[model samples]
Target: MRREGSKAFYIHTFGCQMNQADSAIITSLLQREGYHPAENENDAGIILLNTCAVRENAVDRIEHYLQHLQGMKKRDKGLIVGVAGCVPQFQREEMFTMSPAIDFLAGPDTYRTLPLVIEQARAGIRLASLEFNAAETYEGIDPVREGLISAVVPVMRGCNNMCAFCVVPFTRGRERSHPFKSVIVEVQKLVASGYREITLIGQNVNSYSDPEDGHNFADLLDAVSSEAPMARIRFTTSHPKDISEALVRTIAERRNICNHIHLPVQSGSSRMLDLMNRGHTIEEYREKIALIRSVIPGVALSTDIIAGFCGEQEEDHQATLELLSAVRFDSAFMFFYSERPGTLAARTLEDDIPEAVKKRRLQEIIDLQNSISDKHYQDTVGTVVEVLAESESRRSSEQLMGRTDTNRVVVFEREHYQAGDRLNVLISSATSATLIGRPEHGVVQH
Candidate 1:
């Protein structure tokens, strides 16, 4: 059903891949209801903010945006403003009190009900936020928009692991996997719609389990790969402890599965891991890495690292450096730990790490990782690799940028190529974060 005079809308998304996928679903739903996507906020009748609650900085930014929106709403009286995703899930009533400009507030799981909520809000009714549901799945709604080659499909929602420093468990609630048939159906549709790559997203993707048929994440991956052999398969944010041997084997067997894994090891010290409630030791993490490498030769490894947690000592910092050197991740997302309200760490541990010390340690990790990343790229020089052309290079129009199967960014000079085209490139040069290459003679079939 389409509204006769529905106006254009725009959604500004923040946070992880899950949030991005959620925004896509929202976009699809809005489009189905006759809302056209606007080019910018200034041109839209409705403005939606899909926010993040991962850090306090994110909250501050949202508040600043809300104040700006208040002024926008005052100028345009018919503007419909809404807040969705994790932030609204946590600060429901508080957000309404903070910004009277927000006409609608919807939680992560409540997106399916957004059309009804927005309709009520447009009728000049005060809208209340809906609580998050663990079992909610937006599987049947077709996403109206997607990236050129890569698309994110959220296979599950929320988190079961209560890592002490994280508010995810409290904000998102217990984990629940989406039905396997639904996931496969979505993947097939995406592949048929010209999508080449799919990354299965969740809080802890590897922990996904379908209770109906007793199928786990590995089984799900196999099913998807078998059904959609034309598309590249990948998944993210794997917990170190849950990465099974079968998962590694599946990657090795599948020709279209990407050769990259992002397993987060927040800390290196065993004591720190225990304090963080990570449920895996440093040795266990190393063994998992070794197993992954053994199964998929030359696979690129990446990780998330946090510097200066509550009680991190000099020795603990040294151990972290040692672990980095040993693992030699091709890339890392590094951050200085920030305590969040309602988290176990905030309540139990003292955030005693000096800011200067934390910054210094983070820099050290960055430098080391930079060197490691450079080495990893340098090793690939003179090798021919396949890349999926994404877009033109930021620096020069003459160059095109894409990513290899290992997920390393490659910039090359190529003509007569489009965004979704796959090409083989002969590597000529390497840097810390990029590979310089030229188009080779052949194309690799998917």
Candidate 2:
């Protein structure tokens, strides 16, 4: 496993929590093969950028970064540069042509072969491992996690629902859930190792079903909760159509499950929903939201909204605004539609919306979300919330930063507290993005 130069490796990850988890797994796999982590890119013999292709800008950023890396490769002739994850998967052989600095390409399901690929690259070989493995869940591999307080454990990989504007289904391949027992074991290990919070993540998490016994996502959640009762549990990127009543009740019943649901309603217009092939109508999404609210009162709600989709009119944009106002989401991840190549939208639909119109519509969505989020935070100013102290505040070392069960960021004075300490904090002030608090009752037990 030893190379000629620095055996230190560095991975720059882009995109979602899933990609972060994938990077951790990649680190673990490489570390097992005697590859140590580099403190930074400059010190590494191998540098892999785990990229995202959700938006055109993300791909542009990666391309720009690769251009910068070209100079570094020239400086160190033995430097192994590779691109992994979505971008490499989507781009395939074109990546090598696009970025001459890149020596190899590894897709989302291709990390197991990285050691061999790197070795080949060192021997003057350029290659790609982009084959999709429907059965590859990396079950036995332990990810070399970076953080101490919270970690993301991917419950499943890929997406089955091909929303026309989405690139996930094509990039990550078909849906496959990790073994039920394996996930529980991972959670137990994390809890035993003193990690306080775990997020079970997937592209479409609500559709996860164990291949062994056909146990659904709710069953998996309940099992994880029971396995690690002390650790807070969270899951993300739920498809609105797949969120069942059983799942809602499971969240309501479980004491450890955090009271937050990130249901992505891509567009508010039913016509737009149909165009995207989202598989759910606007009314159905609303009903699901209402059911969730009714079951878990005060549940912090978040969503993803795409503005200016194919054939979007002013009326459709207005409908989206109306939905935002009606739902009043605590937070939102909003973006203008970017037509991903090889997707249904790119193939069939016309990307007719003008760039200026898309930007304007996206700005309106942002403005509305900010107002709603501000109101939500303002309303919580007088209440006390349990905060899991994650790390020192970015602004000041004297303050500790954490998050509420509802997934709101909270910052409080650090009075002999450490990263994993859970504390009850009295909300003193608020911003749209953060809650400033004072420790109410010192450290909370469980």
Candidate 3:
């Protein structure tokens, strides 16, 4: 499969862990066809943008990069550019017209045919495959590159919960879980490859139910933990209504599962919740959090919150602030609502939230989260925590950065340690976002 010239490719990934996993698959496909990975876009023969359509800002960033690539193509004249993921799925003809430099457009499911499409593009043909499929799964392909300590494995594709503001149901199609045996096989392979942590990924992870054998998400978690040799397990983007008692109990019993949950409470006001069609009220979210804490003591909780929606009033905004204060999450990913076309919200609701008000409310949410995060980290001072070394610190060469089982960042000065070592760190200082620590003892070599 080797080509004549030194064909190299670079992928710029944007958005959630699901997008990350798709990029990995695309990378694997390119490598299998004898393309080397380029360190940067300027030096590559091919460039691919794996895009996200969740936020308008993300779309803007991709367009900016496409403009830069267009200029680069004028200089090189041989660069083959492609667009993949949700943006291409949502905007096929528009994306091609928006950037004439783009040579191929492939969606999430069309990744298996990417090598062929790349060949076609090289032969002066524009290719696009945005069709959705419920039966396609790339479970057997080995990723060309993987992180040393952690990796994300997507166990399902698409979403069934049509949250009014979300375009995922439209862009990604219906929900389909990968076979349980296939998922376990992937986890086992990852463990054997020296990956210590694995995060099961999906658009709605908790809603994953095996149609073949009736094994639900909780059942899959228990099965994977029991069979796989990995040290830690985590999952993301859980819907509030889908969080079950059995899942909480399983987390409490499993010693290897990480004690962190990323349940997204988009808004706090009951009216706003109903408007968004999120299928759960604020009280239900609180009850779910309480159940998790009661079953698994000291569990770390994080969330996603939207500050302003179409018709959010001062009272609704206040409710969001109060929810933040009450939850006191370890961290949160906050954003101002941006309506996307083809979504329920865009079709039904008016985009009436003023930009200035949205910005003010978003800033207030950020400020409150900063205080809560600072308090949480400060309380961890002088406590010993286990950390998996991820990489060298960005600021200092003498320091190594890693994350605890609860996903808190720890920066420590340690010599003779590489990226994958698991070490015990004694916290010396704390900030809102990171903890400064030193090795409690000698670094534990893997």
Best by lDDT: 2
What's the C-alpha lDDT at position 222 in model 1?
91
Compared with the true structure, model 1 gives a TM-score of: 0.96
Give me the overall lDDT of model 3.
0.87
For all candidates, the clash counts are 0, 0, 0
lDDT of every predicted structure (CA atoms)? 0.87, 0.93, 0.87
- Residue 372 alpha-carbon offset, candidate 1, angstroms: 0.8
How accurate locally is residue 330 in candidate 3, as Cα lDDT from 0 to 100?
Answer: 98
Tell me the tens digit of each residue's lDDT in model 1 across 228-317: 787788899899999999999998899888999999998889989999999989999999999999999988889999999999998998
- What tens digits encode model 2's per-residue C-alpha lDDT throughout 1-446? 22455679999999889999999999999999999999999888999999999989999999999999998887778788999999989988988988799999999998999999998998898989999999889989999999777989999999888899989988999999999989989998998998899999999998999999999999999999998888999999899999999999999999899999999998889999999999989999999999999999989999999999999989989999999999999999999988899999999999999999999999999999999999999999989999999999999999999999999999999988878998899999999999998898778864
Worst lDDT run of 10 residues, candidate 2, spans 1-10
Per-residue lDDT over 110-153 for candidate 3, one digit per residue giving the tens place of the 0 to 100 score: 89888888888888999997888877767777766566688888
TM-score quality measure for candidate 2: 0.98
Tell me the lDDT of model 3 at 422: 85
Candidate 1 weakest ten by summed lDDT: 1-10
TM accuracy, model 3:
0.96
